[model samples]
Target: MIVWVCYSIVTLIILQFCILLIRIDFYWKNHRATSVELPFVSVLVAARNEERDLVDLLLSLENIDYPADKIEFLFADDQSSDRTAQLLGQWCEHSANRSFISIDSSQAALYNENGKANALGILAEEAKGDYYFFTDADCVVNREWIREGVGSFSGNTGLLIGITQVKAERMLGRFQEIDWWLTLGFVKVATDLHIHTTGLGNNMVISKEAYVKSGGFKSIPFCLTEDLEISRAIQKKGFGIAHQVSSGMLLKTKPEASLTSLMSQRKRWMHGMMTLPLYWKLGLGLQFGYFMGIIGLFIFMPKIGVVLALVKMALQGLFLHRFAHRAGERGSWLYLLFFDFYSSISTLLTILYYFWPSKTNWKSRIYP
Candidate 1:
């Protein structure tokens, strides 16, 4: 029984990996950018207590290669108690195209949402653009970010996801950088296949029409990860979501301070996915199965487990290395070796927290 079960799981894993490999070719088939008239874009940043990294993001936006007249920056400060508002104020004063909104806890209550979603909702309403580019305040985007990202938008395209990279100097930070590349790589492939995939809010662009049609953040049900919910909502309306994997369009973010904080972040993501549609639920199950299958094989069928584990790791490592190099992430292959063990442990722990259901901390704001 154990042998059969492990064998079946390994077979499934291989099948999925094979599909991902084929979809990767989808990236190389088209090396040219689509030519479309550039539309005005509203860059949305919803921040709370992000004083430390906000200025870096502001400066990066100022450096984008896109025309300044065609772009506007909207920052929603969710009742920040620090220098976040002050910095935003200073940036907006010198720039005619930049604006900021202050979101209070009372407004979140009135909107029937939490901090981030509430802030995003307000920004969406106040925005004046054909495209809405959502990003976190702690991230620094590339100069061609808008140029390349917006270039991908043809009429039917509702969403475009830019790849994420981590700027980390510490060992733990390096682990996070590798882990995110692996995770985002899977997201990219799944997206290419038109399968259900959650997007990183820090680097996503959506058409304003799709945002309104999918029931803008205000109409969409409140969730910890608003981007995932909005993505699903947009897809359900038959709008196409695309990916931009070019290194030049990458968005860089800070790493978590500690393992504990990292776990907390994972728990939040797990919780958010748990509320997704049925197909998304199956996708999450596949991730869980991939991790547990190797463990079960090692425990019940040692000889087969060692051989299969090595095979699986090699396949995943090579694929991730290629993707990392293409996406301009360095030292990713070394960290891929540690990703399997780290992911298994982290996924199990995060699932536990997801089920327990308690208030979580994000940007110093506690959410239930």
Candidate 2:
């Protein structure tokens, strides 16, 4: 009975990968590559003690290829004890095209322990662009990030979610960069194929009309997974979400510095997943079954498990090989292999951490 069950699970896992591959192919064929007029865009950034990277991010924004008159950058400082506020003031005093708005600490409310969301809500009200573009304090946008994103809004795209790539400087950083690209790329591709669509908060754009129709950030003011919540809300309202594949629109983020920080970040992500609606959660389970099958093979049938593991590894290798090329990291297969193992262990720890709730400190703020 045990052997049969294990084999059945392994078969299911193989089938899931097959489905994913087919979906990617289908999307590539039917996807509409459209170009639209560059409308006025309000670039919204929420910062909380991001002194180290704020200036770099601001400098990157200055070089964007979009028209200066068509773009407005809004920086919302969530009461940073660091020089973030001073830096913003300095930039605003000198910037010819950007505008700055700081959120007073007294008015900034703690909504589900995520300060970014709180800061975003306040900035949204003051925004004047036809579209709202959300990025992070530590992210550096490509020169064409805004232009490519605005182009996606051509016909009926209500929300445009672009790609995020990690810029790694060390061994740990490279591992994280590879893991993030592989995992997120797979999810984005799968979701584009009628699976489940999720938007990363760091590189998402939404029309102001859709924002109002979906009830704005007020809809998920207290949700830790604000991006996912907003995506679902927009989907519920029947707005189309599209992904931009052009590398020009990529938002590069810094990887977590330590194992503890990585684990905490993963814990927050997994916990947020638990809060997703049932249908979305169930759909993700179909994807996760592939991982579960590998674990089952190790436990019940060593020989079959070894064979299945080899097949699984081959499939993963193919996926990573293709992904690495797209990410401009070709010849880093060996690094990706090790990173995959680290990701598996980290995912398991994240699952466990979700069951046991505890406070975590990040950037001098305590989050539960």
Candidate 3:
């Protein structure tokens, strides 16, 4: 009993220390770029059946604060069966700064399984920007999105990684928003301190030169976690990568409409983590500690574990409560307690998926 207690205490202390280290690093973000020359930026949007949101994204691009001539938008249609292609053509007919580009897999000759990467590679080859920025078609970009991202390309960074927040409209949506904020915020903070951060493909900016130097997306054409793989690849090249917390370049994505959709998404995300290298995987230690702490409490002292779990959840709520308040998300904390339970169950289900290697259905397409 004493050994278990000691182990739990040590784990909690270590996690708290790690959190503090990240907070210190974030507070003292010293890698700001001083260059004033805003390079030409190519905004790459990869879409599949995004007809519902494509128009909004294109319109948002038109409204971005960056110089229209300096910023070029490239839409890579992943052979969408919906009105996505037609809408792109309509948008291109009127928009001078943007073009609707198609992925000719027959020419680039990509395997069916590596469709997205192949499309991105073809687009990257044709992109004429000094910097390449990637975001999904379903995301609504803030007016300063491109400006803020390009501004981060200072003397030190080869890749400029930015933050993303979910647009929560419902109870489930609010839960997802809080979930992403707390979890991703901690991960980004930790990565900044430990130098093991992975980039989210949505709202990521990299110099064209660095992209070529790092071997580009072709380096991992078959990777499920292409964004993370690319970020790690950039790190392997000894270039600096930093996350911009102040710019507020939020990429708005809708939360899963159903629990089934949410589970599938979580499974896919967890399975993708398997492809990461060992050092990156070590980032999961905090998550493991949290899980073990809960389990140990329950098994060793059911009554105590129940109380501690509730207290830990309350702490998590406080963290997220602060984050939501800062991010302008209101009434999100109402479901905070429920999301805490859902997150634990989701983690367990995700672990099961990682070990099982079963087929997953996403966006009406089945992937193995």
Candidate 4:
């Protein structure tokens, strides 16, 4: 029984590895160069009580290489209590190309979408650009972000999912970085094959036409992972969606400050587990089984369990190392070795919360 279980787990891991390879190959073949005369771009940012982060992101936007005349900046102040509204007003006053949208709390309750989704829905309607780009308040985008990202879009492409690198200054930050990278790597590969779905709210670019055809954010069911929901909606409409993993396209964002915060964020994300494709669910189950198998086997047959754990770490490390190098992110090979064990604990806890959700808190809003 133990041997059979081990065999199944190993097979699943290898299958996942093969899928990653396919993603890399497909991306290279399909990646098109950035268009010279790119369409007018609208950079949309939604903020709530993010005074500090918003200021940084706004400063970064000021340095973008895209033409000021061709690009417009739209911001939504989602009923913030702090200096968010005042800061945005000041920003718009200083920048002629920038504008702000106000989100009325009373009217916001009428919408069934998530907070960010509600803000984005309004901004999308107000935007006058041909292409819509999104980034979080906490992220610092590279100067070439628009130059490189907009170039990859073709007529058929509806969505362009970019990469994000976690700002890791501590051990916990490192773990989160590895976790995000692994999740994204698998999803990017699976996404390219149309077998699995993944998206990050921190960075996304969608065509205005595609957004309208997909029924927009208001048309989709509200989920904590609105990015994934919108991506699926657009793709279902037969619009092409592509994943861009180049280093230049990577947006840098701060990791959660504490374990509790990280877990809360993960729980919110896992709350939408049902929204993922069957193949992604199966892959997650196999991962769960693999970790459980390691614990059970270790107790019953110490040697075999140890062997399995070591082998799994080595295989995982190789892929993570390669991904880190490709993305120009600094990750120690040593960190990857034990990352699976660390991640398994969080994954198990997140799965438990997925089945029995706790209070989800984000942007000062709590959902019980």
Candidate 5:
């Protein structure tokens, strides 16, 4: 009796996941960037301790093909103890429209801000463009980034979310890359289906109107995931959110090199994830628990366990194959097995660490 009940639960988990995979949406399928308006825009980034990969960002910025006079760039050094400020100073000096801000104890305290939130809030104040584009210092964007991003906007779209992938040659890096796409797959589908989509700060765009309408970051209370908060605020202002999954808008970012670093990253995100809707939270929780649940079935009923696990993997592989193709990336079959194992362990640890009573660690700074 107990054995049958266990098999039933495990089967249900995979069934729900299959439905999610089936529902994953792609914008590139029927919709393409068709906007005719060319508005002035601001490219903004906030960095602390990003000196290591700052050059990559600089090179990518230089390669951008946007109009010099029409677009302005703002880079902020959030009190980095490294050469992040020095590098930005040099980069910003090359062009009149490019500038960087340094946040010191006085400025940060005056705003009473969370690091990233404070930095972006300051940047928004100085931006004169019609649109604000935001990315991370560790990301590599293509020449068409600005062009494609701007083109994807419809008149009603107050916010646009672009695709961001982890670029790496190592196995661990590959795992993170797969993980990113998988998560974004769900986000894209939910968003297109009219479900609320939280702002993804790494590769995101916001119109000045929506930014102001949402009262921007400064008006909101401090939170670790400023992106999530800002996105919700924008939606509340009755603005539609647009998502882009095309190749031209694809953005690549460096992966965390170590498990310790990866955990810290996930911990920060999971903290923000608490703001997710109940169904989403439950969906994500069950997805993480699927593997552990299978273990119980494997003990109680070996044949059924083996069959369900294999079927789930095959379904996921097929889903990701389509997902990767759309993102202009190559899909891997073997990664499906390894990813399940990796996500299971990491997710379990993240849950434990999330409630273990410690401030979230990010960019070498601790936040409560």
Candidate 6:
């Protein structure tokens, strides 16, 4: 019975991986670059104690290739105990097109801030744009990020998710970089299938019409992965969702500072599990437990386990190659072997941490 279960798990995962590959080419198939005049855009950033990296984001925003006459910037300092507020203040003063809001714990409690959600809620209220583009403080978007993102949207698209990668050069960073490509590969195909799609918090855009229809952040039930929740809300409103992964729309995020930090980050993401439907939840469960499934097979039937693992790796390598090309990234196939080994450990740790009793700490705030 155990052997049968393990075998079933391996087969389903491999089948799903193959399915993604088949539909992968269909992603962005509907995207047609148009010369139509774009709508006014409000660029929003939510920062909490991001002093160390806020400048990079500010610089990126200042250098955006979008027309200044039609663009505005709104930032929120979520009770940061550092120079984050000061930095935002200085940056906002440089242009009357920019604005900033500071939310302390008292104000957050009064508004039911729910961490980043409240900050974004306030920012959105102050924004005067037909569309809102969001990115994180730890991220550096390309100069063309805004222009490309606005162009990626179709007439009916309410939510657009862009690809984000870890840009660090360390061994750990390389593994995470590959991990992002691999994970988002699934997300991209899911978007194509128009099923199980979620938002990329650090690199996403939502039309004001859709945002208002979704009832804004404050009205959406609070969740740790605010991006995913908001995406689901927008989708529930029957708005079109678009996914992008090109060089123009791609963004870079600083890698988590340590293994502990990464673990916490994953823990927060695991909250997304509670938001998925039963079928998708089960499918994701199989994915997260796939490594364990292999081990179970190994204990029961070594040859079958070995064969399946190798086949899966080969397919993953093929997907990565294509994924790199899609993102215009100079990716290395060497990361395949490294990711194969590293993923086993990280997957197990992420699963274990997700079930632990400790609250998830992200950007210095704790979430249950």
Q: Which is the leading candidate under lDDT?
A: 6
Off by over 4 Å in 4: 18-30
Worst 10 residues of 4 by lDDT: 23-32
Q: Stretches of candidate 2 above 4 Å error?
A: 29-35, 110-113, 279-292, 324-331
For model 2, the local distance difference test gives 0.74
lDDT of 3 by residue, 1-368 (tens): 75386347535735564554446444645334565577788988777888987887888777888777798888888778899889898887886777867765463436325566666776787789999989888788888777677766666577877667888667777778777887666655655675666778777888887888888787764656677777777777877788765445566777888877887887777766777668656656555557666677677678777776676666666655554444445435568778867676767766776567677776566777
Off by over 4 Å in 1: 26-34
What would the per-residue lDDT of candidate 4 be over residues 270-368, giving only the tens digit for each residue?
777766767667778888888777777777777867876777676677667666666667667777876887888888878786567468988889865
- Candidate 6 at 19: error in angstroms? 1.8
The residue-by-residue lDDT of candidate 6 on 118-199, one tens digit each, is 8898888898998899999999988888888888888678999988978877888888988898889888887876775788
Score candidate 3 by lDDT.
0.71
**Model 2: how far residue 321 lies from native, Å:** 2.9
Superposed Cα deviation of residue 136, candidate 6 (Å): 0.4
lDDT of each: 0.80, 0.74, 0.71, 0.80, 0.83, 0.84
RMSD (Å) per prediction: 2.1, 2.6, 3.1, 2.1, 1.9, 1.8
**Residue 192 deviation, candidate 2, in Å?**
2.0
Per-model TM-score on C-alpha atoms: 0.93, 0.90, 0.87, 0.93, 0.94, 0.94
Writing each residue's lDDT as its tens digit, candidate 5 over 1-368 gives 76666676677776765776666543433235565567799999999989899899889989998888889999889999999999999989899999988988877844435888888888889999888999999998878888888887776788989889898889999889888888887778778787886888989899999999998877767778888888888999999887788787788999999988888888888878887889888878777667666887789778888988888777777777777777778777787777878878888888887888887777777788
Models sorted by lDDT, best on top? 6, 5, 1, 4, 2, 3
Score residue 247 of candidate 6 by CA lDDT.
Answer: 84
Candidate 5 accuracy as lDDT: 0.83
lDDT of 2 by residue, 1-368 (tens): 75676677667756655665665545542222466677888999988899998978998988999888888888887888889989988888776656667777667674334677777877888889999999989999889887777766645567877778788879888887777766666666755664556778999999998888887676575656678878877777888787765566677899998888887787767767887679767755754555566677788777888888677666666666665454445536667557546766766777677677687665567777
**Residue pairs with backbone overlap in model 3:** 33-154
On TM-score, the stronger of 3 and 4 is 4
Task: Measure candidate 3: CA RMSD.
Answer: 3.1
